[model samples]
Target: MRQSLFVSILHDIQQVNEYFIQTRDATGAPGLSGVQKMTAAFQILQYGMPANAVDEHIRIGESTAIAALNFFTRSIVATYEVVYLRSPNEVDVARLLQEGEQRGFLGMLGSLDCMHWHWDKCPTAQAGAHTGHYHKPTIVLKAVASYDLWIWHAFFGMPGSLNDITVLDRSPLFTELTRGHAHTANYTINNNVYTIGYYLVDGINPVGQRL
Candidate 1:
C-alpha cells in the first residue's frame, strides 16, 4: 500500500468507525477489528469497482474484500443521516433544517424519494421483482434527508429486483415510523431520538405521510 493511502483512509474510516461502534458500544456495530478491514471497505465504496479489483489491489482475499465493501456500504446507510454538532454529545437533528428553511422549502430537511443504482443481473428468485420494473437491475436507496446536505435516514440493500415505492414501504424507517414504534430501542434513526414523526419533502407520494 502507498504511504498516503493509510493517511487518507484513516480519516475516512474514523467517521465510519464512529458509526460502527461495535455492538458492545451502544448498539453501534458492523465494527472492524483491524484497520485493514476499514481500509478495505473504504476502497470499495470510494471506487465502486468489483471486489476482486480491491482484493488484488490490496493483496487481500476476495471474500475479505467483499465483506469490507459491504460493511462500509451499510455504514453509509447507518450514519449518513447523523450530524455531529459542536460537542460530541450534541448531534443536531435540525442540522440540515436550515437549508430547507432558506430555500423556501421550510420545515423540510429530508426528501421522500427513491433513487436507483443500476445492476447487471438478477438472480432466479429475485428476478420477479426486477423484471421490467426498471429498465435494468438496480439496488434502490430510499432515504429522507435535510437541506444542509445531511441525510437523516436511509433504507438500503433492497434488491434491484423491485420497484422503488415497494421497497420504501417495507423499509425499516417507514414501517416503524408509521406505526409510532420507530423510537423503540430495537427501532431507530439518527441520535435514536426520532419519534413517530419523521420529516420528508413530498414528491410522488401523494398520500398523508407516505413511506
Candidate 2:
C-alpha cells in the first residue's frame, strides 16, 4: 500500500514556517525554486528506488521529477532547522514546568526519547542505521522537549543517522552549560540565574556527562 504522508509532512513544514512568521521578521524572497523542485523529486528515492520510478509515479519527466524531489528535500531540511533547531523559550519552559509539576511530570518541562525518520539508504551503508535495524532506512535520535512544551525556546533537527548522545554532543546547550569555564550568561534566567529549574534529561551513554 503506497500511502502519501505528504499532507502530514507538509503540515509539519508549515509549522516551521509559521515560527518564522510569528517570531522573526520575514526575510528573503518568495517560494521554492526550480532546482528545489528537483530536490523534492529526490524524496521518492527515500522509498528505495532510483529516480526513474519516482518520476513515473509522479507522472513527471525524469528531470522534472528529480527537480521536485530535490527541491522538497532541501526545503524541508531547511524547514526542520528553521522550526526545530534551537532551545525552547524560557517562558514556555517555565509554564510547562509549572503544569508538569502538578501533573506528576515533576519538573518535567523537558523530555527525551529516540525517534527514527525514514531516509534514502546509501549503497553500502547497512539498512540498520536508517531503519532501526528493520526495513526502511531512517534518521534515528533521542529528542528532548518539544516546542509545544516550551514557549520562547525551540528544539531543532538532528540527522536521522544520529543517536541521542551524538545529538546532544552537537547541541549548543551542552557547550554553554557543561563545557569550558561556565559563566553568568551560561544559565541566565530573567537576567538573574534561575536555580529552580531541573537539568535537561537525555541519555546515560558512557559518552554523556556524569555528575
Candidate 3:
C-alpha cells in the first residue's frame, strides 16, 4: 500500500472508531499512538505474523495486538463496505464491456481463479477435510479480477479439498444472473449474439456454461 493510501485509510478508520486513537496512562505518560496500533495490525495482516511477534518491533503485547487487529478490521469494514465491497453497478458494467471490446473480447468481464491459503492454526479434528493436494490444511478463495486489477467478485472459506469446479458450484457469483437482476451485455461473436457477459477461466472450468 502506498503511504498516501495507508494514511487515508488510517484517517478514515480513526474517524469511524475511537479505539485507534492514542491515550495517556494513569501516570499521565503518553501511551501507544494510533500509528503504533494500526502498524501492529497491518504487520500482522500483511505478514501473517503471530500476535506476540509484534512486541519486538511495535512494543505491543500479544493480547493488545490481537485486540487492535480485530478492531481495525471491523472498523475498516464498517467504514468502507458499502462503497468498495459490492456488486458492480450499471455504469461499472458498461465500462467493463467497453474495455472488453477494446481488448478484443466483446463482453468479457474478467478472469476467474481459485487460490489456496494454508491454515496453520487449523484444528486437528477438522484437518483431514481441509487437506488437499497440497497435503496440508488450507482454505480456498475464488475471485474474479478485471483488467484494471479491481476484484469484482470474491468467495472465500471453502475447503481446499474441493477443486475449482466444486467451489464455483457453491459460489454466489451468478446469483444475480439467476435472479434476472444482472445487467444485459449484448455482443456479437461470429454472428451469434450473446446477452450475458462472460468471465475467462482456465480449462479446469467447463466453457460455454452459464449458471
Candidate 4:
C-alpha cells in the first residue's frame, strides 16, 4: 500500500479504537507507539508475514503483533465498512453511468475480474482442491472495480480450482440484480435503449447466449 494511504488508514483506525493508542508502562517507561503497533499489523497483512517475524523489524512480540492485527482489522471494519464495503447506491450508480457514457460505454458499470492469491500454508488435505492453473494452492477473489479503482463488489474465499465462470456462478455478486433490488440504468446506444447496466468482462460468453 502507498505510504499516504497506509497513514490515512492508521489515522482512522486510531481514532475509532483506543487499543492502538500508545500508553506508558507501570515503570514510567513509554510503551509501543500507535505507529509501531499499526506497522506490525500492516506488515503482517500486506506481506503475509508471520506474527513472530514482525519482531525483527518492529520490535513487537508475536502475541502482541497478533493482538494488534486482530484489533486493527476489527477497527477498520467497524469504521469504514458502511461506506466502502457496500453495494452502489443510486448516487453511485448515477456517477458510474455518467462516467461510462463519457467513455462510450453508456450502460457500463465497472470492470469485472478474478484474482488468485497463493495459499502457502494450505492444509494438506485441502491443498489438492485449492490448486489451480498456477500449479499452486490459492484462493480466489472476484471483484468489480470502477475506473477510479474503487471496488464496488468483492466476493472472496472460493477455491482457486474453480474457473472464473464457475466462481461467478457461486458468487452473490448478482443476487441484488436477480432480486430486482439493483439500481436501474437506462441509456441509449445507436438509438437503441438499454435498461440494465453491464460490467466489462474477459473471455466470457455473452448474456443469454446473444449479443
Clashes of each: 8, 34, 0, 0
Model 3 lDDT tens row, 62-120: 99999999999999989988777778888999998998899788998877888889998
Estimate TM-scores for all models.
0.52, 0.47, 0.84, 0.89
**Root-mean-square deviation of Cα positions for candidate 2 versus the true structure, in angstroms:** 10.6
**Residue-level lDDT tens digits of model 2 in 1-211:** 2235654565555554442121323674454433334334545554555666654444456665665555566657776654455555556556666665565544454555455656554444565444444456665544455324322232354555565677667765545456553222223444765444444454632111221
Tens-digit per-residue lDDT, 1-211, candidate 1:
6768755644555576553333344576443444666666766665566667765556667786777666666655555434432111113434434444565543443566676676554566665665445766677777664443434556777776666567766887655446764332222334464322335544533221343
TM-score rank order: 4, 3, 1, 2
Give every collision pair in model 1.
81-151, 109-145, 109-146, 110-145, 119-137, 129-161, 130-161, 138-160
1-211: candidate 4 lDDT, tens digit per residue: 7889978987899889988888999999999988999999888887789999989878999999999999999998998999998889999999999988897778989888888899988999999999989999999988888878788789999998999999999999889889988889998878998888999886642221221
- lDDT (0-100) at residue 15 of candidate 4? 88
The number of residue pairs in model 3 that clash at the backbone is 0
RMSD (Cα, Å) for all candidates, in order, is 11.2, 10.6, 4.3, 4.4
lDDT of 4 at 208: 14
lDDT of 4: 0.87
Find the number of clashing residue pairs for candidate 4: 0
Say what the RMSD of model 4 is: 4.4
Return the TM-score for candidate 4, rounded to 2 decimals.
Answer: 0.89
lDDT of each: 0.54, 0.49, 0.87, 0.87
Which scores better on TM-score, 1 or 2? 1
